[model samples]
Target chain A: MDIIVPIKQVPETSNVKMDPETGTMIRDGVGTVVNPLDLYAIETALRLKEAHGGIVTALTMGPSPAVKALREAIAMGCDEAVFISDRSFGGADSWATSYTIAQAIKQAGRYDLIICGERATDGDTGQVGPGIAAWLDLPLATYVASVTTLPGADAPVGLSVERLVEEGYQILELPLPALLTVVKEIGSPRLPTLRGKKRAKVTEIPLFNAQNLELDPAFIGLKGSPTKVVKVATPKVMRSGTVVRAHDEAEIALAVDRLLAFLDERGLLPRGDRP
Target chain B: MSFVWTLAEQHGGRLKDVSFELLSRGRALADKLDTKLASVVIGDGVSPEQLEALIRRGADEVYAIMDPRLAHFVCETYSNILSHLVKTYQPTIILAAATSMGRTVMPHVAVRVHTGLTADCTELDIEPGTGNLLQTRPAIGGNIMATIKTPQHRPQMATVRPKSSRPLPEDATRVGKVIEVPLIESLIDERVRVTGYRTDTADFVNLEEADVVIAGGRGMKKAEHFGMLHDIAGVFGGVVGASRDAIDRGWLGYSHQIGLSGKTISPRLILTAGISGSIQFLAGIKTSETIVSINTDPDAGLHKVADFGIVGDLFEVLPELQRRLHEHAAAPPAATTATADDERPDERQREERV
Candidate 1:
């Protein structure tokens, strides 16, 4: 089984800023990072391959710098890396984003399983993993906190997962060739090995774009995308913090007393157990 | 009218409350667009009786996919079928409740059809000129609300959280057209097979849907001390929640964690104990209609956001409040009826990323 993991190169969210005049994300000096969540995804694939003995191929779609993201996946233990980037692919939304990735996955041939982050931090959409699974017709489980292998690959890889459910945790198991979007419980994820880092430095990543992937122009970019962002602006901030201006301990004592009574009257205090 | 397609969400072959809420939302969008409402039903278990019920609920046309294979929510299968239906029908808008199933299926379907999908939307409106969805959702925590639009796309899609939108009273006998979609074996794969499924066994409050939430923070100091919040929540028929500090300190599980790194909840009444109310914690429950805070510090940060503030030890206040609540058994219940519990996942906080 060949496991393919997809990583995205996103601007470090901390560096994101809006050009107040133009209403766009100011992307200057915003260094790119291998989506931190995808690192867990890459590690999950590598671990699965380690035990199951399958080849792991990491794929990405972005600018030339994106090759580094895939290489990082390689350094983390993936056997191969592929990058898909072109001018035509700019400004694509999640839908078009998944299309680009899916078409690339198809071009790369077969795989038994695909892994990706639960959601990209920059977008926070959490849609792409399931989206790719849909385009590729695979099962998906999201917000997975932990993953434990079950017996039997002939069936779906037995996957024991702990999901953050309605105010609690729900554990479920499913078979392999499935798509999984994980949260923090996949085991701190294996760190990048020195040997693995050395191999990644020398590895050359193959690039594929819309043309090389042989996808129709209409299905490759903004024109093919169903949704487009009309505008982006720095939201007006509201709710200024309040200032307490009393000077002496007497004044402070009086304020505290008043505040306590107010809370009690509102029954803000904890309640007794129900029958 | 620009169209909004609402799923009449059903669980275990039964319709969910969010389905009705979506219908009401869809109805408003339909009226705004000067078009009719389109509702879809999927699953073989939906009987003709159920079909009749959906029409009465306000759908102008209902798309039904009744197949044994489509019974369970296999993500790829649902996406394939829904994407096919949407592409063929071509509604200008689409919506689903942000239930476990909706979140999973909507994103995948949106991608398959090559459209953008917004998640956990709090508000929706129709753009007058283009009839696109003006979908507003919380961003970077609830400190900001971003109203986004997929102006260039058809069938603008999003999933709103349940209870986030109130249900339009269901018209039990209301009626619409029902279109049955043929099944294609090619659309599904058994790449995933289910083994064991364990039901959530903890008997704690469900913070997301609780109208009255009493949350404990790290100041409570231990796992057992969380019981104080639980006692209060029980009296009010509410759920117990925890601040990220409590979870990080191991006083609570990740499931009970609430903040930008946990679940976001806006309850009617929120009573916090020993919490400092960091921006992240406030991000989750700032929408509460009324908030009461208790802390040892006379000037904790929570005092500002909370509608009411108390400067005292929670250990003393909590037990007294619990005793008082029980003493007031003759009093009326604080919140409305319990919210439907059909949702699956807890939440995704902006700060909780790997």
Candidate 2:
């Protein structure tokens, strides 16, 4: 099995906050890190490779800095890394992003399985994996929690997976050359080892640009993306907070009374016997 | 007349509540555009009764595509059908509930129809001059809100967040046209088959659909601290949710996580503890009717949007809230119906136990 994991570098979200009074964004600093869930994807690929004996490749699409994320993936046990970075790839939505990545994959060669995080934190759009599968005309499963090759697999033809759904989880089987967007239930990602880190430092990641990949210029970036963000502003904060104060045990009880009154005013709690 | 189409989703022969909500919103938008509000119902064994119910719920016309092949939502099949419908009808606007099915199918249809789709929109409006659909949604992990428009594409499409709008009251006297379309078996492409479904009943928290959600963040400190949230949520007949921090810390599972990276939820009431309100996490709970925050930090950004804020330790506050809830629960049930049960009163229990 040749496993490929797609990772992304996203602006760290912890430092992003809303300035309460002004209702504006307060970005302490825009620090980038590997999209947290993609770590799980890389780990899943590494574990699959460790069990089934194959090369695990970490692939990312972004600017040059994204190579660092791929290197981090290599540090986490990926055999090789590829960066699909180009000026033409900037401002691509899920549609074009998937197309560009799928083209990059075609250039990278064959793989038995492709893994991605269920969604990217920055975009929060879980469409890229399925979009890539759609673009590639491959079987796809989203929100996969567990994956296992069919028993007695002679160069395994298919894999079974437990996929999350609205009502519950569903068991699904898809043939090889399949794509899976995984949730955290897959497993906890393993940390990088000293040897792996040393290997990562020395490895030079190959880059694939639109020109190199021979992608149609029309389908590569902002021009190719169907949807456009016309406007962006702070979301209106409509509610006003009424802070409750309590210092001691007596004050705490009074705070509870005030809370109950508030709930009653909201018709949340049943109106009990009271004056 | 041009039409505003809402995809009415059904599961196990019952229409999802969000369908009605969509129809209601679609009807309003249709009226604004001087067009008809039509609902597209695609499923196995869809009944005339269901179609009529859709009319009562605000659809002026219901297009019924009954096919066993579509019984289970195969994204390809549904998207194909929808894209074909769009091509034929050329409806100006198409809307669906931002549920699992909508999220999966809409993009495929958009790509096929060569149109644009804004996903998980919290607000939708039409531009007066251009007549383009203005889709406003939280983006960049909810740090900023973006208004998107498909000015060049016909049949402007969007998936509205479920529970963001209220469904109109049913009017039995309402009459509508029902057009039945024959299902083309050859069009369905189902590469994946659902073999079995495993419902996590014991500890499953459908955070998105929950009425009351008690969530915890890194301030809880450890996995065991979630016990307090669980106990409090249980008392309120709600579910427990977690911030991405809690899940990242391995204190909770992803299923319990509410955030940009986890799941988007719009519960009735959400009380978050120890959460400092990262924009990503706040996106998930933005639609909650009542947001109450309890954290030791007074400047915790959560207090900004929170309807009620208690600047206190979770250990101290949770116990106090729990005690008050217990006292409230001990009081007699409300005169109308059981107030202690989960919101919407589990229909199964009503049939089995009531």
Candidate 3:
């Protein structure tokens, strides 16, 4: 089984904060990291390769800086990493991004499975994985929690996986050459070893651009995106918050009492203590 | 006439509340455009009353397609049917609730039909002069809001957050046309099979249905501290929830997670502790009636949206609040402001148990 895992580099938003005085965002200290979700995808691919006896290839499409994500993937056990970078693919949306990636994957030769993060942290759209499946005409499964290869190991017929649904969990059996978008529940991603890090630092990341993939000019960038952002603005802050502060035990007790009284006024506190 | 279509969602033989909410919103949009509002119901054993209920809840027309294949949601089959409907009807707009089913099927249909779709939209509007559907959603992790438009797509599509709008009152006397689509097995691809489903029995919080939610975030520091959150939730007869960060940290299960990638909940009241409040998480609780936050950071983003906030350590604040609530629960009913008719069964159970 040859598995291809798509990853991306995204701005770290966990510690992103706004400037108090200017009200503008302070992005100086916030650096780019491999999208947190994609780590799970890479780990899933590596696990599949380890069990099924095939090579895991990590793929990504972005500016040249995205090679760092590929290196991280290599350090995490990807046999090889492919980077698709070009000026033409700069401003692509989910649709065009998936198309570009699908084209690149096609140029990378044969693969049995493709794995992707459920959604990117920065875009949070979650359309790319499904879009890639559609563009490639491959069977797609989203929110797959666990995947097990069926009985036919040599030429795997299909996969049995547990899918997370809204109500509960559903077990699904899908045929081969399918795409899966995974969540954090898949598995714990492993840290890179010293030897792996050393090998990854010198590993050549094969770079493929739009020209090399021979992607259609119209379908490679912002021009290919159907949706356009008409406006962007700061969200209006609606609630005017009143902060209750407490320093010591006495103040803490008093604060809890006041909060209970507030709940009482709102009918949220339990009414008429029973038994 | 131009039509605004809402894809009605059903599970366990009952229509989801979001389906009705979407129809209500679609009706308003259709009225604004001087068009018709149509609803499509896809399921097995859909009764006539269920189809009529759609008309009662503001659908001008109901398209019911029944088949055993669609009894359970198969993404490929449903997306194929929806794409076919969109192509044949050529509706001006299509709306679906941003639940797991909608999020899965709508994108497939959009791609099949070669159109664009906006996911988890919080606001929808019709642009004047051009008469295009304007989809507004929090972008870049809620730091900014972006309004998107699919100018070239025929059926502009969006997946809206559930409980974001009020459903129209049901009118028993109202009547509308019901068109039944004949199901063909050849059109359905039966690759995936549903083996079985199992709900989490022990950790079943039912966050979406909970009246009150007590959520913890990354600041809780460890998985064991979630017990503090659970204890506080127990006091209020509420359920426990967590942010995506906490879930990622393995502090809580995915079922309790509330965020863009998790479940969207609109509880009557939500109390969040130790959470810094990312926009992605805020998106899930946008429709919550009352929000309260307890965090050590006074300048946390959660404070901006919270109706009330406390600046302190969650570990300290949680125990203090839990103690006070326990004391109150132990106290007799001295001065009851609640009427006998107003007492909720869950509160009574909590009182009896505590």
Instruction: Identify the candidate with maximal TM-score.
Output: 2
Q: What is the lDDT of residue A139 in candidate 1?
A: 64
lDDT, candidate 3, B1-354, per-residue tens:
679999998775666667778987898889989999999999888778778878988998998888877888877788778888888889999999877778778877777786778887878999998999999876666666668888997799898876566578777788789999987667687777777766654665567656789999989889898888888787777889999899878777777989866766777789999889887788778668788999888888888898888888777888888877887877777565546422232333223322
Across residues B1-354, which tens digit of lDDT does each residue of candidate 1 receive?
345688776545655556766877888888888898888887768877667656676687877888776665656567777877787778778898776678888987776665668887777887887677888776545545566777766678888866665555446556678877777778665655434334445643356555567788978989898777777676666678888778767676566777665666766677788899776677677666677787877667687776666666777666665655566554554553222232211111101210
Off by over 4 Å in 3: A14-30, A153-155, A246-275, B204-211, B218-228, B231-238, B244-251, B259-268, B276-289, B296-301, B311-354
Per-residue lDDT for A246-265 in model 1, tens only? 33445444544454355445
Clashing pairs in 2: none
User: For candidate 2 chain B, which ten residues in a row score worst on lDDT?
Assistant: B345-354
Error of 2 at A217 (Å): 2.7
- Could you give the CAPRI-style class of model 3? acceptable
Docking class of 2: acceptable
The lDDT for every candidate, in the order shown, is 0.69, 0.79, 0.80
Task: Please give me the total number of clashing residue pairs in predicted model 1.
Answer: 14
Docking class of 1: acceptable
Report clash pairs, candidate 3: none
Cα DockQ of the candidate 2 complex: 0.46
For model 3, residues A1-275, the per-residue Cα lDDT tens digits are 89999998887664355444432234455688888889999999988888877889999998777798899888889889999999778767777888889899999988999999988876777888888887887777888888998868366778888777766677788898899999777888999878878889999888999657978887777677777777766776568767788667877777777778777767777644531
The DockQ of each candidate is 0.28, 0.46, 0.47
Winner by TM-score between candidate 2 and candidate 1: 2
Evaluated against the true structure, the overall lDDT of model 1 is 0.69
